[model samples]
Target: MHGPASSGWLLVALCAMTGTYCLTRMRGGGATEQRRAAGGEALMGFGMAAMAVPAAVFTPPSWAWSVYAALFTAAALPALWAARAGAHHLHHLVGAAAMVYMSVVMAGSPARAHGGGGSGVPLLTGALLLYFAGYVLLTGVRLVPVAAVAGRNGGGGSAGWGDRPELTRACRLSMGIAMVAMLLTL
Candidate 1:
């Protein structure tokens, strides 16, 4: 990340925490799809944390960038398969692709080489920014208390911490915001 070390650390903390929470969610009893979704989110959170690490703290070897790109590209395949069952999986696919895109852009950038501003195609960056901004807004709206009241009133009673929809939405929203922040650095 091309920014103050403090901000980069903050992003790292947020993403790592989110990833840890998602790992717990995966272990909790839930539908297969839900567990699968949580698993994917966990992967994304950890990957983002790694990518968000301040270049000044640890500049990865040149080969590491290609590895990152390859990893996300491979991750996208499962997301693509899952997308056939649910629209949420489509979001996962996009997120994986975005990570791959960032890895590739960062690999060739002189700014990253010097621990300065990141370089990327302006148009693609703008498009990704717009998509993530919209996702953050939509996820934020979904997290409003009014939306939770109905679920609370349902006969299911209190959901387990890991299975709580609100928290899942909040987690997604946080990642969306993080994505926007990451893109801005680019």
Candidate 2:
């Protein structure tokens, strides 16, 4: 979060709120896959919020980066397994892997940890940026009223808050935007 304090705080708020909503989704009586997805989203949202905290406010210890990398690595395993059931889970896998990648990059570069924009591999960052940028666009298009209506009707009717596909897509879209912002900082 190498931007202004206001922008960093905004990122923190957006991510924390998304994480909270995902937690509630986990408690709702959605399908198994939906609940599972929510659980992973919750983890990702909260982790992003923590990482996005401005360095001026709190710089994590050197070892903490390793811990973040490890945690996300663990998260990715289930996402990889879940992808066997649905393609959407692959997005979760990529997100988790991206978190791990960022954590490692930050850990090795103290300058980046302090928001000085250290030497992360530009090529890798560009690749991730491209992926998440496409994701944000795709998710945004899916949020149109026509697409929402189709998704709802296809689901058989109104669903509980947690099972609402539109909300889930919106959540993912927000995360995708946040990811793009974060990568730009890198």
Candidate 3:
């Protein structure tokens, strides 16, 4: 069996994938989808990477931390506005909060040889993990049938993203898993 030490790489890879997904979502026109894909997602990717790969953000200039904090906090605001529309907005809000928490952890901690140490708040981490895990399980169940349908149709269906059930569910599941991976590194 693989050891726990090796698992960090998987989390790192997931972070990269989440970043890529965010960028791709920028190109997609779905209102809800695009809303979740806000610019803060790239920062979310960076925040997660910093957690998994110690060197990634261990020693940036002081101002970078401030920017990250501001950006992530700002990102969460819209999610509040979007929350009335659906649970996905709530996910975004949580994701943004995670990013902000991460930024604070990174900014305050001094760089060290092994990853930099910070005051990791367990309560927050646990909450994030729980939420994301549920999201992944739900997403996985949704994807099973979508694969069969897509195969039969030769690809994604012709319906608009809002009209396509699979697309939104897939995105939710993807980000949820990504968030879980990120939280694990903390």
Candidate 4:
């Protein structure tokens, strides 16, 4: 209940729904890449929920910072390793790192000290926001109508989940926006 409760719930619902979609995607029997994508979706789903609480309540447990920071940090490593595979992997790496950064920031405060102000905003926070904003926009544009985002891993046509590129891009875009919302609340 820090910002508008409705907005908070909206984010929560969005994240949860997307996460469930990811879960379904996870079960999606395709290539290794499809499974990886599904895993990221699940993370975003739960991650959004984690962020949603603080967005609404304006307060998160002190321990949550360490937990999220560590979780995202751990998530980042695999993403980095996968980066050699393609540009999408690079994006995933960056996204994971962004989550880590946000977690660390929230952990340090844990009481909404950074709320709606510029006095104490970290320099890195700005950079992170810039990256995510660009990511959201880029993902959005790439998903225009019939145009598919590249490096889907599921290959083209009849690939089931991977066959539909928009869903994949939407997941990334949604998480990026969610991350921005979480950062602003911090």
Clashes of 3: 0
- Best-fitting candidate, measured by lDDT? 2
Assess the local accuracy of residue 157 in candidate 2 as a C-alpha lDDT between 0 and 100: 45
lDDT digits (tens) for residues 21-98 of candidate 1: 898789777888888889999999999999889878888887887999999999999999989988899999999999
Give all TM-scores, in the order shown: 0.90, 0.90, 0.67, 0.81
- lDDT (10s digit) by residue, model 2, range 68-176: 9999999999999988988789999999999999999988995654567754788998999999999999989988763444444355443456766687788889999
Off by over 4 Å in 2: 146-159
2 versus 3: better lDDT goes to: 2
lDDT of 2 at 148: 41
Candidate 3 weakest lDDT stretch, 10 residues: 110-119
Worst 10 residues of 2 by lDDT: 146-155
- lDDT for model 3, please: 0.62
Alpha carbon lDDT of each predicted model: 0.84, 0.85, 0.62, 0.70
Candidate 2 global CA lDDT score? 0.85
* Superposition error at 186 for model 2 (Å): 0.8
Clash pairs (backbone) in predicted model 4:
1-56, 1-57, 2-56
- Model 4 Cα displacement at 136 (Å)? 1.3
- State the displacement of the C-alpha of residue 81, model 2, in Å, after optimal TM-score superposition: 1.3
